[model samples]
Target: MTDGDEQVSGPAGGSGAQPADPPVTGLAAPNGGASPRRRGPLWTALALVLALLACGVPGVLLLGLVGDAAGRSAVGRKDDPATAAARRLGVRMTAQLDRQASALLGGDRTGFLAVAESAARPDLTRRYAALRALRVTVWRPVADGAPAAVDGRPGEWRLAVTVDYCFVAPDCTPSTVEIGTRWRLVGEEPRLVAVEESQAKPAGTRPWEVSDLAVAVGERTLVATTPALRAKLPRLLAQAEAAAKVADRYAVSGTPPDRYLVFYAGQAEWQRWYGGGRPKWTAGYAVGVGGGHHDVVLNAQSVSPSGMGELLRHELAHAASLPAEGYSDRSNWWLVEGLAEYAGADGQPVNRHEGLAEVRKLVRGGWDGRFDSLAPADDATDDRVGGAYGVGYLAVRHLVDRYGEQRVLDFFRAVVHEHRSLDDAADQVFGDPWPALHDECVDYLRAIAG
Candidate 1:
């Protein structure tokens, strides 16, 4: 990941590595579609993940609009009939929820008994309503067993009485929708477990049409272009698997079936997609994500012998881990880069990209430093790309080996739970300051690099 100004406009140049590399502009986007579709949902489901990603970041959902959820007036409304319907369902669900919630909170035995008894009767919520007219389904009493008696203890409780609202907006288009719900009793009153409601158009997988070597991952779905590139998919999967085995700190689902989502971007859209007209970096990336979906996209031109899977791996790693750059985390730069690079390989050293060696050599001091652990990554404010991976990777490697795999996981978890300062963690765990520890790492790398 080169800096913004490091654009290679002319001929591609590089160290004589096996697979050449692209002049990368730190940021890129997956090439999926806003294509028209039929059936289930393509963009809609994608929107959920995207929305979640956008959460706590700037400008998601609202796009440019404004409103507040969990407030009286909701902002960022996508008020299409489907969304409105979902909102309506949310409202009714909240009402039924409120009743049980009241019973639970007030500890009103009489009120609770009335609601609980009604809850037990067959189809009680909409007992009198017609299935066709109400369009409601009640699958109450879900515990992987029979219904339970509702009491404060040792009793079965059901809270899910689902309702689907379908009223066409002034547009007069008959909008169809559905929502399913199931609730379980925590003590006596039922609590919501599943509430799914959305509008969707089953869409096609979006891959950059021009590229023959992009990667994407989902449920049993790994799509790329050519057989040569496809061959690399297993390696990505393998790397994910091995890394997951080493520690449970990097992915969501244990890497068993990567919740990873891979997308391919065609050559045409590459210029416009990410990095703006030139190239740029993006926020909201997972530098050390444990799981969920990740996208690996590539351009057609990237398959040339000059191209390294670095960008694919970088972005994918960011998808898996995180890709915070600039002011976000001046301290953790080295760490995020090294972990991604380590995870980027196809498992076999023979298949590893040679450019990586260039990086490794640089860290080792080209026969200079004593080879302890590279150098401390300069604060992110410096904008120097070299130190981030050099220092951080060595530190991570040392920590992983020194503490045992489990402790390394514990360290990462500590970061998540006690995410304050590296120096603090060092002080707390190793009884040292971060800067002092980093110097030791540099000396260590220098020693090893020799």
Candidate 2:
């Protein structure tokens, strides 16, 4: 149950005494032919006459040319039969999607399944049930671009569909993900046959799509666990709700998500679900779905009940503060991880003694005293990673001590959410340039290290 075992997907990093999980894995045209003709002597003579007239053209010939131009314009204005058919199919698919969305929102399983092919219905049924269990409030799937015709498949088409969904009602913002879908025309009706990963750009798999879930809805949280963990739902839900309250205190940007969605992943799910390939040491992580909404995933087998609270607080803080558009600059890793560490350590010690010891070690080893340099390397040992998390916590604590919590939060929002430059954000929030602020933080670290 090490504190640093949790990771956050996107720009912001993790917090606590345990090793940090690795960064969240970010998820991301034609030819022709021709022919020739032959002509007789009379036709050749007529063609020669026409060619001569066209060079300086007779008035009637010019008028004929104008008429031909007008005809070409008319043809260009009208869609070809193939194009017209595709348009009609697009309309039908749009209507079908609307109906499916309505059915999902209204909990009409039959209606939702009406447009699905028999082969796809079983998987869709499972998905619908999972969404219902998680209390999904919104499920809108819109065609991203025009449906593309599948090669050599006359009645079948492929489309990129973007789906928007939300678990909590009214106050919850919809998070979006894209899927590649295959559809076929069954007597002029569009039938969904498959929903799959897009080869061009892959999206993270939702928890419900991974396995059967047992859900527990709390006042400020929704915990979805596997059937094996159903008996512990009450305990997990309670821990999440408590953590949400602590995290709410740091939600300075705006109202926190209507309900913090948490997923408790079983052993198999822990590896395959929600942006996979996390280090084995990772006990939990938070991933942004879209629209400023992030969902937390806990490795059910790895994290203990007692350790869940700190991890939840750290992740929920990310859900509360990370922008809809995630940050990419790794230089801001310290502030990103530090803020979470700060919020997570609320009412608890800042892991001070261990953090200071690490800082002292770095200083004595000819460190440059740059906070940016303190983040753990990708292959860093657990002890080294743990030390990085410790130093990050102390750095944030220093900010809170010098400037009040609100000011620190304002600075974080400006840089991370608002995407302002560090110098500009620091000067705006703290009345000093970033370099000055950086030097001050370094001085504070050195003093504490000593």
Candidate 3:
């Protein structure tokens, strides 16, 4: 929602209501003679007007003074010299940003670096190269607000900037992020001094911004990795493309993304980038970056080559099927994770068996036959969490088996995306009440576990 319309206020006098003329103090006599009371007030008014004219103040100036006193204006006030200067600075800085964006898109390194100060050129150059390597189709930097002058620094200012960019072509839905930038005006030109995270509006760093990337592009996937994993880029891309194809089969809600953007994070990066709150056992995650676009991040050092395919499939399924607004509640965690697990374990019987192993162990422990009981705690062990995922998968699988895959997907969309009650969605999609469906799913899970 960057570059939205600015809100504007109405003109000088609020409600555009004019002030009433001063009340007539007295009436003229019927003999065509003014009363003494009226003559006295009229002379007083005339004397005040004459006094203002004697001071060399024009009638318009008199009116303006009156308006000022009344907290209104006959005409709008002009911007002060300082305010006007800052506005001009913002305009110049915006033009400079436009040039920088154009330079990055056109692959003109020299032109891109030209807008930055000498001290900033090196970092700017690195950013330019990273973005160019990513092959972003859209790069627009817009001023989020007016520039503010830096205290004690002449001709220097700071501004909040929002950048919108996209990776895929033909359906380039841009993702927007905010940045804080500093600039110094040298004569009529503005040079960028620094770019940093906006304290006012922080956003997750893009993969290119995290480190130098070894990028491999495929027809339906783009895999980016650190130089440390450059040797593994091709294998990762092949797996990701394959996973994307599998993920596309579940796109009953809409078309799959044009290209699945994947970032393979090394050990150091896994701890630093993409908001960094994932559990240690978590393999990968998908982030909805706006406009139905998503980006996948993988723990490259943690997952094995054999396990990577399933992990990719799970996250990619999320990318393909997750609604723009995301799921409504954690109560639907089963459907959320289950759908991904079902997609990941598709056509892999051994994987399915391994996934349900923990569920079987829990059933032997006399656990309650409720999916709610399978919801993992925040600090749950990896095995327990895996069991929960397995239970979710079974729930989804049961629905698919009884009703069919498309119906299951539709029911999922109704509950998660449409924010409908599970019972309501079940009644609509399956012609059964929620309790009946819930009991059926629980029975199926226990039977599968046995």
Model 1: residues >4 Å from true position, as ranges? 1-221, 224-249, 252-258, 274-294, 303-317, 323-327, 345-388, 416-418, 429-432
Candidate 3 TM-score over all chains jointly? 0.79
From the highest lDDT down, the ranking of the candidates is: 2, 3, 1
Would you list the C-alpha lDDT of every candidate in the order shown?
0.34, 0.66, 0.65
> What is the per-residue lDDT of model 1 for residues 291-351, given as tens digits with 9 covering 90 to 100?
1223333444543433334434444444434321111332344454445444443232422
Off by over 4 Å in 3: 1-77, 150-156, 198-203, 364-369, 372-375
- In candidate 3, what are the lDDT values of residues 312-376, reduced to their tens digit? 88778877877754543556667877787778776665334456677777667666767645555
Q: Which whole-number lDDT from 0 to 100 does residue 290 have in model 1?
A: 12
**Which consecutive 10 residues in model 1 have the weakest lDDT in total?**
10-19
Question: TM-scores across all candidates?
Answer: 0.39, 0.78, 0.79
Candidate 3 lDDT for residue 167: 72
The positional error of residue 89 in candidate 3, measured at the CA in angstroms, is 1.1
**Number of the top candidate by lDDT?**
2
Model 1 quality (TM-score): 0.39
